[model samples]
Target: MGVCTSQNEAEKIENSEQDYQKLDFNRVSTYQKLENIANNIAAQQQIDTIFSSLIQRMIASRQSHILDMLEKMDSKKKQQFMTKLERIDFEFIDSLFHHCYKQDYPDVFSCNVVQSINSQEQNLDLIKKHKVGIVFLCGGRSSRLYDKLLSDIGLPSKKCVVQIMMERLKKVIMIASDNQEIVDYPIAIVLSDQNSEKFQMYLKGKRDFGFQSITFIFEKSLPVIDMKGQVVFEQENQAVMTPEGTGTIFLQLNSFINKFPNMEYIHFLGLDNLAGLPLDPQMLNLICKQKGDALCKVIETNSILDDRIFYFAKQFQTIKDQAKGIQENSQNLGQMCLNDLYLSVSFLNTLKQNHEKALKLNQRYHTIRRGNNIQFEKHIQDIIEVTDITILHQTDDFALLIDDARKAVIQLSNVHKRNLKLEGTQEKDLVEITPQMSYCRREDLKKIENATYPLII
Candidate 1:
């Protein structure tokens, strides 16, 4: 009977312990959930504080639309946007408003713009005097050409535009070396971030097109702004962005000025145009003699030019007019303005001296249509608005522009046939002129004039 009583007492104690354990489990779970809810609320409050400050700044900067857009976004999107808003370059945006929206253009009228009077002998002499550097703007992609670097010459030679260009430079260097001592011309290529990796991979350890001095400036990208001036998102975390502009080339090159300390003038060339020779003696001479800050190559052509090409907004006066704007229609009746430029280092230095002004002045912003969003871009030619530029009016012979594959083939063939004196050759005829054979030397091409149809010289 005593044993039974003891067992009953132990059973009661065990049952009480089990009941306590069950109650403790419920207490812990409830506390855990409440703690998580409190933590989430705290996190949201912190996000609101930071983002509210950003929104206030946006409103202050006249970007209230951005705040409105933020208000309409769901919690997840709002969080994502706030994270990116922290990196928003408010200074660049403000500068855009300061120049573009306010119509605060550089005093282009004060700058001298004159037509070039060629003196080949004088120019050749000047070329020997001034140490010039070549800059290639390869930041743009050619969708129509099916290439990123515009490498294909649309020829059987298997030579690319860059190879041809470098060969031509070598030829020019050789010719210049005959008269005077010189160094291999410095080359600075400005490539966009998208193309830089692929291009650098192809060009790795190639000694930068076989030149001693080469500087690679990767163009920066700016965040894409929607039609409402809000940053556009490609994904939940990825923001859509575009390359800043050709203007950034100068901004970037300024930092690497020490690389080409001996270079007195910079000859800017677009990667696409093969007709214009780099640092052409004639243009170099004009830049040296006229004492002008900048020189622009202008062509008077009625032919349908590419949409990427620039146009003269007005007739050439004492002050050469800058381009009407970027992406003007081909039907616009005006001289075709090539972005190829010859600029004195002194002018670049002057820009550097006025760094703040230069930064704000050069960022010419325009809205590019991208579905519901807009992209902002700047042009190399916009520099003209800030400085005095000489307009070198070139003849139609200088206008072998390539906008598409067919046009490239036709234009390149025509140029080759005309130079080679291949009379019966049609535009569709595929001819290959190795850069080594002749770097656009008429006399050298004459030797291969009678070679053969579909010639590969």
Candidate 2:
């Protein structure tokens, strides 16, 4: 088309209808694929009807060539991926496009009155009584962590992220158990398609790190759309796709909750944060004290970088325009990052009732470009509601993927065995003590020469 600015662009458009196996589908071949799927359905083969409706819509939309591309694949691959085809519901898309975030909700409540703990033993006791569960979110592309292959980046002690996290979990269990009978806690990870298989294989080659078992949650893939609102293809058959954001965890939240029948607390940790505690007693005290539904843990800071974590704590309905900056909250949330969330299991169940309705009410998409095509994605923070929320100040929380990953590593080294300065706070005596540090930047670890002080991490 005249819109193509380059040769590859023109070729991509041409290849869209003529690639391997010739995507140039006639009306007959399109119908044949439909019949094949229908025959499978008639034979009582289980299939998600979502895909059937989606493929039919593609045909009606005059882009039936996408189906031709699939038909060209060998029957074996075709059968295996029959359901992976992303479903596009036009009505949903229309609604999302016209949807406005106007639902006003409550702000985060801080429990400064709840006193801090004096030891890990206290934290352990809270864990035992509450029957807590941990859900780690690692379902990301990890595009920035590497330049090429995943194996390219080196790690400390020749250990990968999974190894470090697993070892830490083992340490936590040992400490919490305190030589008594082992207490089993539920641990779930929401994995992206890119890292799911790799992590499983990586774990297989190594030991379980200490826990007897873990739960793996896989996310669904959604298609990338063009400026014209059409799904873009990545290959002859595969369309460019990304994992449904953090909200995808809602899909498996019930199962994870089921793991701990007596669960009173659930902590959702972003795998990147090395400073967050696996079984923090402070978190335990806050949730119980607040009697909250969905609670987010926020650090108190005025650092410029903290702005990235500031999200709309609650949606305001009846307001025609969305506010550009965050409003002042009980705490300085505008300059605070959402470290993690601690929820009462009962409260979490309330969110698990209706996935579609919850997503429509909470999730919002943002347009961005990846290589050659544009994409619409929702942020994890968008789905989370700060209900009966409590802002717990974590002095030692550290998350990766900062503006400068390398610099963040340097800061870790400096704070290895020392205290860090609070950027904007009157409480000068309070310090973040790391009972354990679970992750490291490979290159930064290499830079440190033989040092005398203890690198508690």
Candidate 3:
């Protein structure tokens, strides 16, 4: 009887332990599912760092929490928990890491020159000697200017903004050199699918821009759908959507690099800023002098209102994982922010560093979650200062002489009328015309001259 009783007690203890194990597993499984869902959402939103941190926290806490719960659960309840845990896939964590870290590995830099900047003269020479690539980002909708690239601004010749810009660029290149072969650089004008056909047609008959090769790449648009999967802009016959932000440029950059293996530099500018100064060889020479990989043009903003006229600098966070004895807090990645300055090479380097760091973090986390704890420290690259040219004022004669001459002519025309004597006695509208009129009238006689006519004998 004593032997039989001992045997029963041993059986009961074994069953109890098994039940506790099952309950612990169930809790872990549920937590894992919640984590996986969160990770998926993060990846879709491109919140890579946040997702990695959350996943690491959940996994680390899982084992301890499950073991604690086992100590309190009854045998029957424990078995139920085990069944629930069985439904959760342990392999999911591995899969999540892989999905989040796609393209996280660094690519080999095989190109002779990873980055190069050439002036209008040198650029011409470079294009002649090597394959060159150009990318024009045109993804913006005509929200501000009524969707017209060629709308007349009431000028006498009815020259549109884009037309004027193209003309000035052509003139600048002509002045740079007489070589016609410089047009060989492959120009890719990135446009949206909605505007692709229209843009292509616009470029079809116009042949004088002096570009030897031109290609248009259309960005894929995603439909704006609601939580129920219903399209938001269904009422409109055409799809209504927002243009994906400028981040898409990096993706298309690879293709540009691939096509032009010897590509030294790329110039990117906006469409509406028609007042852009000519691509001077001096500016290009400055860029080349610093060995700058990327260059951006900046115009000084004088007032609060002018701030909107300039693109603001971006701030990025540097993060390191804490679980692997790494620092996990966000730190400011670059230099102190400055006001009134335009974006330059330092700004571009910040962006490049942010991209590279994010990629490394993804790879590190991916390896870690797969039960491989390889310690990889993440660091942001330091940005070097390069030359920053304040875009000369539109009224500055050097820039005005080349591009804004027509606008200057309009100003001069108004001044000419203001100085004329009128028969009617009326308070002169000096407030509206005083400063420019007063200055022009005082200088007009001395400055204006007519060609001497040949005298008839």
Candidate 4:
């Protein structure tokens, strides 16, 4: 009789516990989730991160890309994104499409348009006096150009990219000096994994390029991982690889700047066009004199709608439809502008320290192709993301470069206005521009400073 009473009591206790749990099921689940989060936080606070294959891949694809993406996504979105991306095929696709370097850049960099300052000639002259150094981002893989066209005459000589770049810098020195004060400064070239060896060989004895010295800083190249997580092979022993973008610059800028202690400022330009000054003297002066760490020089450019006005917009206006202000603003790319950036050594160190976030400014990625052609690029225009940017629009004293119409084959040519100007692209370029689509040259600094022409940021 006592044993039966004990069993009944135990059953009652068990049933009571079950009834309590049923009554507060949602509360129990919430507590469990909170506990899991607490545990995750504790695990993350450990001295060293627990390494998984995915973490390893994140490190490989530039740690900042993963970190930035994480920061950008909220808790729920991050959980969903990460969980969905962890599967083998999905992770593989994510890795394959990682925004290492994309070129077409239909959607890239943007900034709040602020009121700009007048052209300061004193700034230009002061910066010019410091003997500023120049660096060109010239490390393209050349695979596209090669795939597009075969060797022309004899073993299809390496494209004249370096030659053309050197010629442009020579013009800059001439403008900055009466061919004298800004003489004998080294121009650093950031080479890709693909072009480092080739450039070293090509530039071996070439001093005709007019740079007192040319420095080659090679960027890292990582193998392309396919959807199966297997390395994509480019040739027998070589795996497919692409160059790390401007993040490379921010990471290595301090070290490179340290090497040239005499240089006060570094002028950076990408290889896509030779429109901006290799070293804009006024820009250097502004950067040197400003309380801020950096300066981004740009010019007023006609929007696509401005170009289309002659042909398409008139036709489209007949319809009752009108493009929204935001939509219309998208068409006006500040093409006449060449972002002539001037960075001080101190600022370079700051950029190096905060490189992960600063480089995020340049995180414009464009996915292309099934696998082989995914590309990523960071333009100098994106510098505003990392700094207190002071906007300087085109002035009459500044040279403006515009790509000429493709209707005819153009050998590189120059136009002399108030400032020296050069346009026309390489003979091997695939696309050409229309006259209506051209970037207009502005040689009206006097008018700009006098408020005759308002400065638009």
Candidate 5:
């Protein structure tokens, strides 16, 4: 026992394991109380007031264990946690303790039924009638490639990933507008704080890419929790935080979407999806035709698929098993849904309203080790519970997911050999291509047949 710390508290805990077990700890009630206290403290402006209230609540609730833990931590660390108390979610942290330390798992729902769209032409016609916007999900920090976007085909150009995506979006906008010029088409980029500034800087004063209304929304970040469920600090006074799962975007973007009353559908795509053309006219037609609220494009995977690819896409099995209506197909390994999605603005509103129902669908938290700290992560796939979505299953993988530089090189090489039919003894990183080059269509590659290495198109 340290003389500087709570010696009496240490003696009580060490006296008997049974006494610790007997401590009611009623976690659910404790969490409710803590959540209330936290909300009250957060509303206050004064730091001293906040800390005093937090301490008083803990003592009043007879949460001696938490007090003991806080006492064991150095005064400076405690001060840091208390100072940043508003940013921390005590309920979430308490749940993490139940999951990580107590081996308690959240309920998982299984979906077994699969439904398909009957008429594509009908859906296409419906798409033309409704006004659609685009939701670009690219909230992740580029921790791997040292760049936010990378091209597999070595394209020598000043265009960044955002630029390339916008170029494609220009095509999408023209096509969606039937080759006529349109203005104020909504496009929102959901990104993390780490990359939001970089993206805004890159986009500032640049051409709108045929889009007048472009919104940049930052994803919510949560404090990192240690194994003991204590919040971790990155610096002397700064608490480490990671972006919450993609599902939280609805909460963040709901109010923003309300600003555009005419926007009916949201075409969701990932920034890293090099080949996924957003505002797809055909997909819009189909979803609108079916009168579906949401459309999710999932790739059917088998054991033959690469493990990295499997990990990259969230497993469709979780959806099939947990979600009630989806039926299973025994022929394939499982379906994997990338970020390529088309959702109705109405459904997004419904999802935002039923956020609690979405949370109850699954406890998809995974413990990730970042540097010296362990952080819990949640996923957006939880929204499947609330949304009535149409699944578009594809046999071949169309999403050219280029997350890192190494994957960019590998994917680029494959594209050259398969689509361009230009397999030669060339360095992988040296070959260059762009979306404007072929749009991943083989017929478009005819013009590039005679292209040489260090190829720039």
Candidate 6:
């Protein structure tokens, strides 16, 4: 206990020293000039008084660091620093600068991609004319199945998991045709560089799946190597990792926005859900009706031990703004608090209320080390509403959570079924192909065809 206490004390002292170093103002040259400009900008404030005060506090806090940097620099270095400072426009930086120090912003951040709520209402007829885009994030290795995404599963006809998923989606598209209120959308499968060739082969000339349009996009991959410069997996020789997270979907959607600028909604699904049981177009339509930006699908489980369902909460943090040099004490660094928030339709609505800045995304796998061993587990959750998209938390039982279930259903049979099917089954046939396939197929195919034709010539 004594040793632990001493270590804690030492850490506290070290942090304090670091803070003092940050407070030193003599090392900076343009500190005074920047400080004066900030003060002048604040003085000319035609904006909110609170905003002005916040700016003032930030400038004052940063003054010490500026002075410290100036005092330590030589004349030549000081001139260079001033030139750099000139490029740092206070207004432009202020707009992009999220105040991590105060946690003043809300958990959700909504982009103005869609024009306006009123506009959507007025153009309901027009918006309904277009189909929703379906994007599947299928860029992961099928280590669990020990094959590529196109491998045949142990079923009759040997249909791979990806094929089954595509077939099920075809069923949904068929059902959607009867409903004139919704438009038909295409299915875009996102593949990583490693599995592109195999996927193309599986999909080639097979248009019977009935998707309006089927396209593929490549997710960039990174190689994993050991300290000795040996590749981790021979298959992954030049393989890359998955994009940062599912949140990357937002970034990917930007490219299509111009062409389909009027698209009001997008439906995202995981590639592994082979059975495709839970994703109902009607439920998605209902969510759109409720004006939700993003809708998360959820299922209730009898066993509290199930790791799939995520409870949302708000996380708080106080951050130091290095640009403004202001430490606004301790403030809430708001995030969707995963552990505290309950699973319900109401909770979904609550998130949508703050949808402008909130990101509705999922974390796939989490790694943990136990003593000398390491373990990995899937952390899957249902529909994450990104914008004001309404979330329909469809459950089988309404009486189970009568106080909270808004769109819950009750069954006539006495057999109690509380859980709603949330996720589709993962098809096992999708194998993880090596990067060599991508490079080899292009070169080898050309050589074989050319060699065969040369004899005839």
Candidate RMSDs in order: 14.4, 11.5, 17.9, 15.6, 7.7, 20.2
RMSD of 2: 11.5
* Top candidate by lDDT: 1
Ranking by TM-score: 5, 1, 2, 4, 3, 6
User: How high is each candidate's TM-score?
Assistant: 0.70, 0.63, 0.44, 0.51, 0.70, 0.41
lDDT of each: 0.60, 0.50, 0.38, 0.43, 0.56, 0.36
Model 6 lDDT tens row, 238-320: 12232223333433545644346455555555544332222344434454554544444433433332122233222112233
Over 4 Å off, model 6 = 1-128, 155-158, 178-184, 208-212, 223-244, 277-279, 302-457
355-419: candidate 1 lDDT, tens digit per residue: 67587666455544546655567777666656755555454434244546546656666666677
Tens digits of lDDT, candidate 3, 1-457: 0123322333322112233234343555534434444454335334443434343333432322332343555655645544443333334333333442333553211111111223323344533444333455566455334545655654444555456555555554544455354455556776876677777666675763666667666654433323222223323122234343333454465566566666555555444343343343444554556544434443233323211123222222222324434331113122122211112323343445586643542332211111222111111111212212222111211111112434433433343333343122222211112221222223343332331211000
Ten residues in sequence with the least summed lDDT for candidate 5? 1-10
Off by over 4 Å in 2: 1-56, 59-122, 147-158, 181-183, 235-237, 299-334, 351-386, 392-396, 402-404, 420-457
Better of 1 and 4 by TM-score: 1
Write the residue-wise lDDT of candidate 4 on 126-227 in tens digits: 334544677876665655343111122111123344554565566556555556744556578877767777667766746545455667777765445554
Per model, state how many residue pairs clash: 1, 6, 3, 12, 23, 50
Superposition-based RMSD of candidate 1 using all C-alpha atoms, in angstroms:
14.4
- Give the TM-score comparing model 6 with the true structure, all chains together: 0.41
Instruction: Report the Cα lDDT for residue 306, model 6.
Output: 17
Q: What are the runs in model 5 whose C-alpha is more than 4 Å off?
A: 1-50, 55-82, 100-109, 112-130, 143-147, 150-155, 205-210, 289-292, 300-331, 349-373, 395-403, 423-433, 437-447
Tell me how far the alpha carbon of residue 385 in candidate 6 is from the true structure, in angstroms, after superposition.
8.3
TM-score of model number 3: 0.44
In candidate 3, position 8 carries an lDDT of 36
